[model samples]
Target: MAALGLSGCSSSEDGGVLTVAGSTTVMPIAEMAAEQFEEETGTKVLVSGLGSSAGIEAVQNGTADIATSSRGLTEAEAATDLVTTVVALDGIAVIVNDDNPVSGLTMDQLRSIYAGETTNWSEVGGDDLQILVVNRDEASGTREAFKKIVMDGTPFDRSAAVLPGTGQVRDVVSRTAGAIGYISIGFVASDFTSSTVKSLAIDGVAATEENVENGTYPVSRDLYFFTKGDPSGKVEDYIELVLSDEMSQTIRDAGYLPLSDASYQARAKAAGAEEGGDAS
Candidate 1:
């Protein structure tokens, strides 16, 4: 299957196949944007989920046109003098077993739960049961977001269940009793029916699109696309395509909240610079 995909990518003529890499958290949106881009402009885009760090490496090496990231890279990335663009915003949501009675929680309570201090749900207003924690892999930006928000500057409990990816986190949480975890809104589907996992409110605010867009979601973050310095080629076009109206529409379709006005305007500026560079 990988071989076939490579072949397909190699066949593009509009501007040659544009290679992109990055976080699995942003892969679905990038993929959807690429599909619509090809449909509209006859250009092809090749996207890969190589982990965010690996994607940054790809851009630094000129191996990819763009690097989609859920979290910004470290200082080392900035030291390279690469150009970064904000393409979207996302709200990382805390998901719990639907049957669990506890709904909203303050960030402080979350920190206690993940720290293994608040073991009984009854302590948080739910039925008596041992607290079960599910976490994303360390490399994932989703995990980082959780750390910054829910963990309250503390580390996850060593006894917690750690999954390799967002999908795995979701799957495990959905089926496991007393499960609680976090995931990007995009991975959620209508039939994710384990019926076991549901979204929980953070700090008295609900985890809905409206809340995320309105800045009520405490865990909201900007999504980025990192590129090599002074983008001035087909690569630039590919990045610009990500902010197009159709691309924005796809984001809405993915069940994730759209970017706020400031985010949208910033992306527009970045796109203009990039696309214009390709022109000159």
Candidate 2:
């Protein structure tokens, strides 16, 4: 991996292309950043939302310069020389059709519903309508995070319709009367006042950015950008720009928690000190 990156360095110096592929959850931010980076540096960045697993695989095969993921790597993936960088923090919001009377769900109830134990809305304080479950495909980092954080040891109901991306799951849920799905909170905007699907509270706590930052949100996870060994040249530069103070507002505007919040306090403080020194 390092050899591939070193080999590509010469090309990067000549305004070569940088390929980034990964989680659809991270694609929007990457696309926005790519636009700005291109404008400033004149390097062409090719970004694709091909699911987290695919992105990791692309990096492993030397096809992609970086991979964006919403979940941590598996044991097998961690064993490789790949490096992980936490780009931001996000919540996995449980969403239901706007017409669904059901609002919030307890963690246990949500587990049961996904496990096929609770099949109807009435079972969890809603109408008598049959519950329709929308799920993301195996390749999705969002699905993996939901499985680990929300499902825990419980297996997902095989009968649920599985889509390949976050947007697809949300779209299906929004159009289906009894459908419920989980997606990155970033995609939902500030709230669901105008959306066809509304977000639900988990264990009585709302899936808001504040709750996520305070550690009250149960389904929150760190967003990531992965690379083969360590990044170099344009790859390193791009990652640095994404993590820099210049991108903090962009991260916030995209609905994900910036590095200034939650677990990133120390780093944020350090960054501030460095900026202050430079100014002085």
Sequence-dependent TM-score of model 2 = 0.88
* Local distance difference test, candidate 2: 0.83
- Model 2 over residues 142-240: C-alpha lDDT tens digits? 999999988998999999999998777778888888888999988765354345678999999998888887778899877889998887888898988
User: Which stretches of candidate 2 lie above 4 Å from their native place?
Assistant: 1-15, 190-195, 266-280
Count of backbone clashes for each model? 0, 0
After superposing candidate 1, which stretches have Cα over 4 Å from the reference? 1-15, 189-196, 259-280
Q: Which candidate has the highest lDDT of all?
A: 2
Model 2 RMSD, rounded to 1 decimal: 6.3
lDDT of 1: 0.73
lDDT of each: 0.73, 0.83
TM-scores for all predictions: 0.84, 0.88
